[model samples]
Target: MTLKDFLKPDKQANLEVFSVSPRLIPVNKSINFNLYINSSAREGVDRFVCIWKAGKAIQENDVSEIAKKFGHIYIAENQRNHFFKDLGDNKNLATKEKVEILKNAALDHLDQLFHNTDDMIQSESIKKCLVECEAAAIGLMESIRNYDLFGLHDLIAELDFHDHYTLDHSINTGLYNMMLFREINPNATNEQLKIAGLSGMFHDIGKIKLPNSIINATQDLEPEEYIKIKQHPIWGRDLLQQEGIKFQRNHLNIIKNVVYEHHENYDGSGYPNGLKAEEINIFARMTSISDFFDAITTKRSYHTPLEPLDALGVIENTCGIKVDPYLFERFKRKILKDEKLDSALYLPKDFDPCCPHTALDLMYEDEIQKSELNENDQEDVIHYHWAKKTQLPKIS
Candidate 1:
């Protein structure tokens, strides 16, 4: 079934009167139900005093005092040990294990949020997701510092084949952007890296506002439908602006720019104002390349997935036209040199290596040859040429 089929209509049902428990007796007394008696009452003003009173009461209670009032006993007192002994054991976990734990937690939280998007408050959900993204970014930076690229790639690729396109694409884009940003500026601060990571993760938040019909379409879009699709960037930017008030000014700006300009091409051929070259925000420019790479490599309703090498070639070929040429070249070199992805070209276990040639294979024939040549050339032709021309720091 299509995604549209999964979304039930927004139904507003009245709260049914169920049997009330003794525990709810006091709680009901504390709340002023009279405030909600009027059906036309706006929650903001009508419930303000009631909510404030409840919040004030909560703030006045000390944790230990509340526990005592609730007749709870501390096991530590009877056992002659600390109450939270198990919590400290995590400190002994290896750094790699810690990073993996953090990465998995982040992805799980994101998956939950995406699945419950219709039921949760959007602003609150986005805020929590950003916090998780920042934590994951910090862990990722630590992993990169230790040169644990293989483990990192495996963790990311584990989520690569999931059926949820938007969630998987957001996560992979964030990861690819983080890696590329670190390579481009190895000396960048953790805060800067986190911003890049967060930008990539939320760049497509606007798509959440699009009709599922367009988003999940298996066929090509009509001209009007494509126009609606193009408006996603604008919607994303506005949504972030409205909900990101708590973010630091600079971080929020980075997010807004990335969402707004991620689709704009380097050659002024893109939509929502055809920003060209440096006119596009730098974070947006970086995210654009990563976004394109993830989009083409991931399977979607409209197209078959392309192999990593072939995907890179498509990005390389579109350099200066769709993406920043300089950035694309750097990103390409990094992927080709990454030892972690050495087996990236190998077909998955279910695939037949000798299967009939597909359209992608034919289109990427020349690019595939270049990759093979780079692999087999004793002189290291690609590296030699890159070193001779580019001003990049030497790849270790």
Candidate 2:
């Protein structure tokens, strides 16, 4: 490997490396693991340069000085286990640091389990990963209860994502699920948050049964193909049940429920069950919100990503129809408060991407949205235009 590969963090390779929140470090404490500061080389590659050696007593002034320059600190892969133990043992690790640790570790586990492995992940491997993820989820919940999760994304490290759509999207959905629940119900129990994270991560596991031709298809699918695609939820629910029995994990039931019902709409328009509002599971409702948000915002060979505000407008249009209205309102508040957006964003008056559920019309609209004709837009017309919908192939 090149020296740059060793120093610089790449989403594909350096997922082994985890980040530290500088703000979470207790001033004047002697940390067991070494800490590195982020540095950009002349060639524009990021380098993690070790600024503090292991077992050194960090001075308050020095800690503050480091925090001024870098919001994140780096821990090499070798120190990952030690760093996690430190976090578990220490009482001072707050919401921000726990988030950093949780995301970093999640990428590692998911990459190992689901990265190109179609021959069914082994049960032992699955258990080990779940046990680890469960621990991190509990710690994150404790921190959430203690310090609160406001201004969270800013304090956490820059996340490194997988190139594969499911891998990267799963991470975003999982995080969004946790954040949405916290915003909607700040009194969530530890078990509830743990379920939230795992359920979101594995929500689309049903799609693994589908062929790659369907998943990566740039053009529209045939009628038969679309019918086959819609059965992933059923397949996923069955798989989750089998694993739950074989592995004896009682909590997998909730995850299975979400897996089966994530696509069900609030207005009873979705498939598998067509269950309406209040009839759907709460976590599944939350998953739909995250699924809609992340699906529209991710760029693919077939679709371009949407801006945050524009995407928010699209979601607003579907608040009661496609998603739970109450949860959507809370999610909107959470996003606005977290992003600190003061000004309104422009959107198309007639644009709604979710209807007809056909690929050509939706894809055409995606291109149109990017065209010059739509100069300034303010979509979802609360009073302006009657913005209705858009729903792309929900990537597995």
Candidate 3:
């Protein structure tokens, strides 16, 4: 299935709840998490039967045997924390494995949030979601914190353009914002990264509430249209709050303020409130820098995408106008420091749905099509799936 199809809430009435990458599961060891392959079902529904139970020894060949027929895996949504925690505790996990796990999890979580936050509000699923979000976000932060300013350069490799722009952009913005937070504060705590990462993620959530027909009716927006666009921050802020639900007040305040004020520009020239200079929140200011960078680099309907270096120059011109000048400087140096690591690593989503994409699919199209079962070649196909099913390694 397409990532969009995999993420759709309308499809959730079936057995599958969440997806995971096979790369996230360890080889030659009994995993703490369960893994599933789909059971044949009614055409439109997915009923998953666990193929690998938790604590069972998983031989490398056993995973391949399951993967040969059903190319993907599923995990329960509630097991997200356990999955991440296991990844963190596995001292032997490779850097590449960690990168794949983080990239896939980020995209999945952000996509679900974008699509289901509305349902969360209507049904009061907000509290449960927030707890899950915090655990997932913090786990990601802890796993990558030792990498310094480079959160995950291989994750940058998947920053290639795609139709699923909103969700992809949000994931990039959160990772970039988290890295920038560390650059600004070298000893940033997991709590600090959680606020920085999630605020950047939901910063533009307000835009989703507006109708696309109204948003794209003209080349130049009407004054009313402008106001509607500007109000996303307010909607985003309000969306995080639920009546009678006890949230961590301070943490919620930082997250809400960033979403509410990220659109407010640096000098005296932003929207909604137009409060100038230091009046704009710091986390919001940091997000503006990351948000602007990702927006310009990625393909958008109104404009062509720019190269990262070229995008940096474009961001340079808007230093004081669109984003904070000081924070932009920090973000720039961080990008340059890690530039060589991702020199030619970007792969489009369609080609590499599972992240930590090593481009094996493009190189081995023929071999993959006609290859016979061989123990030596089994590990090769694990990077990208040929068919679809729920198998995010049973979110544990």
Q: Which ten residues in a row have the lowest lDDT in candidate 3?
A: 349-358
Each model's backbone clash number: 0, 11, 12
Cα misplacement distance, residue 318 of candidate 1 (Å): 0.8
For residue 346, model 2's alpha carbon misses the true position, in angstroms, by 13
Question: What's the TM-score of every candidate structure?
Answer: 0.58, 0.60, 0.61
Ranking by lDDT: 2, 3, 1
Model 2 bad stretches (over 4 Å): 1-104, 115-121, 136-158, 243-250, 334-396
Write down the TM-score for model 2: 0.60
Tens-digit lDDT track of model 1 for 236-310: 887767744476778988898999998887767676898988899988989987777676565565457666666
Clashing pairs in 1: none
lDDT of 3 by residue, 205-321 (tens): 666576654433425556686667667777777777757546688987888888888777665566668866568888988888777667655555655555666556545544555
Give the number of the best model, judged by TM-score: 3
The segments of candidate 1 whose C-alpha lies over 4 angstroms from its true place after superposition are 1-122, 144-155, 160-162, 334-396
Pitting candidate 2 against candidate 3, the one with the higher lDDT is 2
Question: Which predicted model would earn the best lDDT?
Answer: 2
Candidate 3: deviation at residue 163, Å? 3.4
The predicted structure with the larger lDDT, 1 or 3, is 3
| Clash tally for model 3 | 12
